[model samples]
Target: MPVGLSMRLISLLIVFLLLLPSTEMKRPGKGKGLKGARQNLAPGRVRVAGRHSRSRSSRLVRLPNCSESTESGEVFVDCQDQRLTSIPASQMWLKEPKHLLLARNRIRVLNDMAFRGYESLTSLDLQQNQISLVEEGAFQGLTSLTTLLLQHNRLVTLSEEALIPMPSLRYLRLYDNPWNCFCPLDSLIRTIQVPSNRKLGNHARCAEPITLKGIKLKQVDPELLCKESDPTGDPMEDQRDSTNTLKPSPIRSKPDAIAACHTYFFPQMRMDCRKQGLTEVPTGIPEDIVHIDLSHNSISHLKARDFQGARSLRTLNISNNNMEHIDTGSLAGLLHLRELDLSDNSLLFIQYGVLEDLYFLSQLNLGGNPWMCNYSIHYMVYWLRLHPAVRHSGLLCHSPLEHNGESVEEYVNSYNRECPKDRQHSQIDQDTDPELWQTVMEVQREVEEELEPSHLKAPQKYQIIRLS
Candidate 1:
């Protein structure tokens, strides 16, 4: 070999030796690296790694401040006072929680799936929250829920379907909330009033309609509370007419049937006072009488205290009589009254709220009466329209030549179409007689004064005033 070639090879060898340490350092170690690679390549090890990652992610997404525990195979969650505006999504993972305490929170509207996951929940305490507007089916999954404390919440109305899912619910605390006592609440009231059901808390009272202030929810008359008048005109204007010269017919001689007033005890206690020529409601009627028939009589007026003695009266018949006026409170005490017959009478006007106290009145016969077609009759029309259960057949209009013989429903529709703007004021044009118009205006002013808060004096004595 030549001397230069030997020197170049020696330099190459030195360079190779210099890179040897770095190459070995860059390569993976024999034991640790190979073992790790083998383990990662295995299917079981890969699944374990993926599961660990998922477990770590799930643990990180825990509900803040919500604590849960198991006792006797039942889970109990305590998320109370968490300042939660809604139910935490993490709660959906709870398995058959038996008790859930979410009281003293800031929860507002309870959506339909608010408590969806808690199907086995037996007790739920939602008191002292800002909850309002519980959507239908909010408690859909709470089939096992028995105790529900909804007191001290902002709930205004709850529909019948809202509680249909919780068949096991026995104890319910509903109090300290503003409740609107109206027709929609009738079924709820009936449900809560059941003897076996939980008692409605004392704070459950009317929160609207100044007239019904402080009235207890249990004591509220569902029928009377549901009666609503027209929002536009006075309901009493319909009966005002030019017949101010007509007077109520005087009572004639009593019929011999008065001596044979039959009393029944079967099915229900009832008194038959029909065709006895009764000038007025007969006295000495038993307080336990459930029904009374005084049809075909000469009774001209129904005084305020006429039915005061028959508080238990369920049905009253005064048809085919000379009835001209019915004073307010005349049927006040008939709380359970279901049917009333005032058909074929000479009624010109029906005082507003006169039948308001007949809370359970299901059937009313105003047929064959001389109903005046004006703004005053708006209340009756509105009431009849609102309550389809009210039997109002044959309610014909007797005045206004254009609407005469027309049903009250047809007359109302015509009135709304023709005199939509100023029907109340049009009464003056309907009656050209200034005297009659003046009388109506004076009567209207008197009624307004009577309705004033300051003028709420004792009811005046019943008077036999002429309706001419």
Candidate 2:
């Protein structure tokens, strides 16, 4: 009777075993598959080589202050001011971030491989950091970078090769650093002067060599930086020996003076001494000369008595000279002088009151001078503003990065004279109407011509004849 019951139970067990699921079915959701393993792990967990499993929170977590976004299969990172002392190597995971902002941090030095593989980076901001040294090739792979901001850092100098990789870089901010303007900085100065380097203000200023401090790198004469070989003779002995041999010689005869300079007696005694390579003003010129063209020479200084005999001189062309200093009273006796051309000179400083006596001065050209546009040049700005007829367009500032490429008029207008504690006076009033000054100058010329000799005055087409 039990044989049938045992046989039915065996059949039920076999059916139950057949209905149970196989091991392959359990493997899908049991943390064996890739998706299952990922889901089983906790959020922000990462497995690093040769280290125990750790959560990202254990390390410096990049907060929302730093952000990332995926666009066009590339990630862009913004990690600005996250108190980051060094750039995270994890950025390599991005392959090549298109935009990175690491500015306003405490990054003291950038290693050579800082951006080794970030070739797709188009913009980078490292401004307002403590980056004193950027190792060569630090930005080697940033071929697509168009903008870089490194302003307000401690960088004293950078090799030309550091920027060679960034051929596409169009904008750079490198001001507000203590730049030593020695020979190494000449290349950078020339680079900034390139027209394509737009918005980069004048080259950095020199902070060393007390004599050159506060001077723009572009303004320093290249010859001043040259290292001359030691002279074979004792400098003092050579000077004394030469002085002993020098004796007062007789003055040049009148014929010799005229022969030295190309002169003309006709057309109101015009003297064309231009391009003669003369270092000093020629002596023994006729007193009746009205125009003296001594331009394009190598004159470096002008004494007060240079033109004492040329009191009747109405025009003096001294352009393209190397004149650095002119005595205060150099132009005093030229009462009739109306036009004076002193353009294209290497003048660094012009003594005050040098132009005070030129009351009838109508035209003055002071362009192409490496003017030190600082507090000391306040008087010159004030004078130019007072007389708008002066050619102010060509008066570009060569110093003070903030005022680079700015005209003298624009600089004077924007300059804050009150910024200097020692400044005694406030900014001069620049509201003088240029048109009104032009009218006054025209009237003054008419009055001066009436006082001149009839032969010196312009010929009139008609004359007034009165018979009584």
| Maximum-lDDT candidate | 1
Model 1, 77-131: lDDT tens digits are: 7877789788765334435467887877998788887886577778887877988
Residue pairs in candidate 2 whose N, alpha carbon or C atoms collide under 3 angstroms? none
TM-score of each: 0.37, 0.37
Off by over 4 Å in 1: 1-62, 70-73, 90-95, 200-203, 230-468
Q: Which ten residues in a row have the lowest lDDT in candidate 1?
A: 235-244
Off by over 4 Å in 2: 1-65, 70-75, 90-95, 200-203, 218-468
* Clash number for candidate 1: 9
